[model samples]
Target: METVIVLSRLQFAFTVMFHYIFPPLTIGWGSFSPIWKRVTTSPENRSLPPLPSSG
Candidate 1:
């Protein structure tokens, strides 16, 4: 019984931590990545260096 309770609490803590941590990071990356890619891979910046977006 105690083992089950501990496992349940651990699962709950993991779920809560995952929910709290991932959403903001994913949202921020989703929003910023495209703009950063565009900036880095722009035609005007081509003379500067090769970017991942260009590849």
Candidate 2:
């Protein structure tokens, strides 16, 4: 019973830590990727048109 309780606590802690750590790491990568692309890419090669704003 004690071992089961300890294992359950460990699993819960792992889940919480994973959830806390994973998102910002991914979000940081997602956010930085565009800037990295822009830095690496030449302006002339970027051919996408600007979208019109609804506001």
Candidate 3:
């Protein structure tokens, strides 16, 4: 029973940690791509209006 509990705790911790690492990297990379594209393709973006300030 103790061994089972320990293994379950380890599995849960590993899963939680692995799950936590993925989203920020995925979202960050996903978000960066569009900005990078805009920077590369749109010369006018350099002087265009700033993005609307979000609340």
TM-scores for all predictions: 0.72, 0.72, 0.61
**1-55, model 2: which lDDT tens digit per residue?**
9999999999999999999999999999789767666655667756654433338
Backbone clashes under 3 angstroms, per model: 0, 0, 0
| Cα RMSD of predicted structure 1 | 3.3
Off by over 4 Å in 3: 41-55
Any residue pairs clashing in model 1, and if so which? none
Q: Per-residue alpha-carbon lDDT of model 1 for 1-40, expressed as tens digits?
A: 9999999999999999999999999999889877777776
Overall lDDT per candidate, in order of appearance: 0.82, 0.79, 0.80
* Residue 17 displacement (Å), model 2: 0.8
Order by TM-score, highest first: 2, 1, 3
What local lDDT score does residue 27 receive in model 3, on the 0 to 100 scale? Answer: 96
Quote the lDDT for 50 in model 2. 45
Worst ten in a row by lDDT for model 2: 45-54
